[model samples]
Target chain A: MYKLIWHMAWNALGRRRGRSLLVTLMIGASLWGLLFMEGIYDGMTEQMIDNTVKSDSGNLSLFAQGYRLDPSLDRLLPDSLLNQQILRTNPLIKSRSIRFSHTGLLATAHAARQVQIQGVPLEEEIVHAGLSDKLAQGRLHFGSDGNGAILGHGLAGKLRVSIGQKIILSAQDRQQNINSLVLKVNGIIRSGNQPIDDKILYMDIEQCREFLGVSQGFSQLSLILHNPDNTALLQEQLLRELDDSAIEILRWDQLYPALLQGRQVMKTFNLICNLLVFCVAGLGVWGVMTVSVLERLREFGIMIAVGTSFQQIRAQVLLESTLLGLGGFILGAGSGVATLLWFVEHGLNLEVFQEGLQAFGMDTIIYAIIRPDYFTTALIAILLACTASVILPLRRLKQARPVTILNSQ
Target chain B: MDAFIEIAHLHKTFETSREVSTPALIDVSLTIPHGDFAVISGPSGSGKTTLLNLLGALDSPSKGTISLGQTMISKLKEAELSPIRRDRIGFVFQTHNLIPVLSARQNICYVMRLQGRSQQEQESRVAELAGKLDIEQLLDKHPDQLSGGQQQRVAVARAVASRPQLLLADEPTASLDSTNAERLLDLLEQLNHDEGVTVLISSHDSLVINRARHSIVLRDGRVVADHYERNDIP
Candidate 1:
């Protein structure tokens, strides 16, 4: 009996080729637009978060309790923290980099700007953040003399200094004495992080320590965990074991709340888009089904009078709507998956908006992420829409009097 | 003879959205015996269709009781009436309301399939009915592909294919040419004598009325004449 009803539903849809095709394509086109928009927007958001994590904060960062607020050399995390057992033996910590940062004046022959000078161990910095990949021009290595410096592309642009140019960096030492050092630019980096690309200049840690006369302390220690999901767990364990009075532990999201908010906003936007597109698709299904049922009132009446139960008729109508929805879903999902796969392999380049993208800490090329839940959620939503779309029509069918329907004929 | 359908003081009214009232069937009482070939003749709005609809359990009467065999159907809910309608009654409409999407064979086999009959049973019954109605060649055609007579024949086949104990046809011959009308009357007669299926048809045509073994005449929603001729069966 079910097979017969299914066959009938299939035939009914096939009979009205134009209307059925119109509805199927309408749903397909809307779903395609929705999937493409979601994939690309999410890609853009994830890329922004990834850049912030890699170019600046690792999964987690540690600092002196008051250093974030005052950012002075006096609040530096003592070098002894590096010898902590968890820092060296814990498997959760993938790699760690110690950074010394201080606000200083950078003066070139033609231009001068105030920038943050960051002292980083070159080999460890490369392993932690793929620093070499950020190099836009010149070599990533400093000279054998350890006097080479790398400027953020934005900072380099402001000073109009390319590789091989000599620049002077000046900052107050730990003894309250002013110190200045002359360094030649070795590399320029564009990390696509707004703060990093706009205002930071990197130098060798040993060179910076010698120049500033800071022999034993570092400002911050950033840890990259093997599994980023374990960051909070490690933070919790560290908080229980370490002296929280002297050091503050912070996750990447805490350090960059705006990036987290950006991700949330994109997610909500995608949800709203999904609701709107599927609602319209549901309405499209409703419109076609209502017309189909209304036009067949006489036939339904005859069916009812001949002992075809109202339930059977209802089943037939529901089956028809479901078939149409499935047709649209298959078409839309096929095209959507293909498009996402292509974009994943070869990223979508938005280089035309390079400056705008950089301002938001987004890379010029974005690779899409395809999760299995996307297809499952869409399938469930579409089936629900198809089922909900037929409720009114089925009620109308049940209410229609067989006598009146038969008599009208 | 045992009563196949019993009606008592049946009344049906139609009310418009504006609170206007019109009566479709008045306080009429009647009894139809098993295997009787009957006709209800009346002018339009005289309640012939309304009477057949009530007997078929397609609609409820405004007042009184209708019992098909022993079950009181007038007060039953639609869900309860569905099984009675499906297993005990079959209907043929003037427009031949064949489902447009289904081929003639599927249409004829629809009700039996709904009853969960075996595939072999549905096929054999469809084949037998197709042969009887001279629709064997047209079995593969959809309703739109067939002529009016062919479609009406298919409708009759669909109506009787399940072998319902009671068959109600409203103006079954109203749209047919005289030859087709005569052929349909002949088929109904064969079912009545051979299958013991009680047939009730609403019609105003003299050709249909003259062939009935029992006749009821209505006017102004009231029965004015009813009589029985000699039974040809038994």
Candidate 2:
């Protein structure tokens, strides 16, 4: 009986091939589009989070309790014994980099512009941070000279200086006195972050400390954790260890809430788009099933009159809709996943619109990534949409009088 | 052979217009015993089809009782009526109501399939009925692919393929030509005489009534004439 009912369903589909294909395409194509959008959004979120955490704020940052309020040299979190103990004893800390970050002016033979000076211990940064990977040109080094320096690529372009050139930087020392330093352009970097690439500069932490005339002071201690998610727990642990001193521990989300909120907004937008697509797809299924039942009413009446049970008839109709839904899902998901695979290999480049995207803190190149659960969830959603679509036609079946239908045309 | 169908004071009303009820079968009673070759003849809306619907348990009567063998079916729910329709009664209709999607053999095997007959049993019965009806070569063709007569023959074969205790046919030859109609009537008569399958056929065709040993004629929703003509069958 089951085989025969399936046979009927199959034959019915074959009889109306165009309508079946149209409905299947409606569901499948929309589902594919939804999956693709989800992949791109996920990729964008991952890229943003990685760039923010690895390039700027290392999963967590340590500051003096009043430093964020004042941001003066006196407010800096110096190398305290208690803070060093907390940083060393924590198992979640994978690596650490110390830096003295400040804004200064870069002067060349023909140009002078505002620039950011990040005095970092280069060796520790290579071990702990993704800063080394953002190098678009030259090596990630301060050159052979001990007085070597690195310039953000955009700043180098603006200065019209290249490797082996000399530049002058001047900033206020810790004592509110102006100090000047001359360094060679050892290397240049572009971290795909516009603000960072355009104006940032890098030098050794020891040099920065000596230049600032501070014997044992560091501006910030950036902690890279083995598990970034452990940032909150480690912060709480550090607070516990310190007994509420003048130290502030910050997680990546807390340091950069804009990224988090942007991701949330995108997620909500994707969800709304998915709902709209599914609604249209579901309506297509309902329309096709309605027409199918209407076209076969006489056949159904005959079957019911000749002892095909109503339940059995319902099964055939349900199977027909299921088959249609399944066809669409497979078509959509199959093509969608294919596109996702391609995206995982060669990322989609938005270089033509790079300037527009850069203004919004987005990358020029976007890669797509998807979890397995996305496909599973799509299958369940499509199946439900199709199953619900059959309800209207099945109700028609339930209310039909075989005698009356048979006696009429 | 002791199986019988008894209908006592059957009534069916149709709502033709607003706040008006028209009677199709009015206080009708009928008894069809085992192995009876009976024909129900009538004019349009004369309740011949209504009586057949009641006897087959397809519709509930307005105010009467109907029993097939010992099962009281007039008041039974729709759910209870299907098994009787599936297991005991088979139907053949005027339009040669073979499922257009299914081939001739599949249509014949449909009711037997519903009865949960084994594949081998279904195949053997289809072969036997197709051979007996001289439609063995038309088994693979769909209903539309066959002639009016061939579709009717396949329909009759389906009605008997399950070896049902009762076969209810409504205007089985109404759409056929003289020759095909004659051939179909001859087949029904043969099934009744040979298989002892009680047959109740409703028709406007004289050929149907002339071929049955007994007949009940209805008019204006009443049984105006009911008789047995022994000479008609032999």
Task: Give the top-scoring candidate (lDDT).
Answer: 1
Backbone clash tally (model 2): 0
Candidate 2, residues A30-122, lDDT tens digits: the string is: 989999999988887778777767667778888777776776677676667435677777789888887777778889989988987788878
Tell me the spans in candidate 1 whose CA falls farther than 4 Å from its real position: B16-19
Range of the 10 consecutive residues with the lowest summed lDDT in candidate 2 chain B:
B225-234
A111-174: candidate 1 lDDT, tens digit per residue: 7899988999989987887787788999887789999999898999999999999999999888
Candidate 1, B70: how far from true, in Å?
0.7
Q: Lowest-lDDT window of 10 residues in candidate 1 chain B? A: B225-234
TM-scores of all models? 0.96, 0.92
lDDT of 2 by residue, B149-187 (tens): 889889999988988888999898877788878877777
DockQ of 1: 0.77
The alpha-carbon deviation from the true structure for residue B192 of candidate 2, after best TM-score superposition, in angstroms, is 3.1
* Candidate that would win on DockQ: 1
Enumerate residue pairs that collide in model 2. Answer: none
Model 1 over residues B50-120: C-alpha lDDT tens digits?
88889888888999899898899998988888889889998887778888778899899988888999999
Superposed Cα deviation of residue A329, candidate 2 (Å): 1.4
Give the Cα lDDT of each candidate: 0.88, 0.82
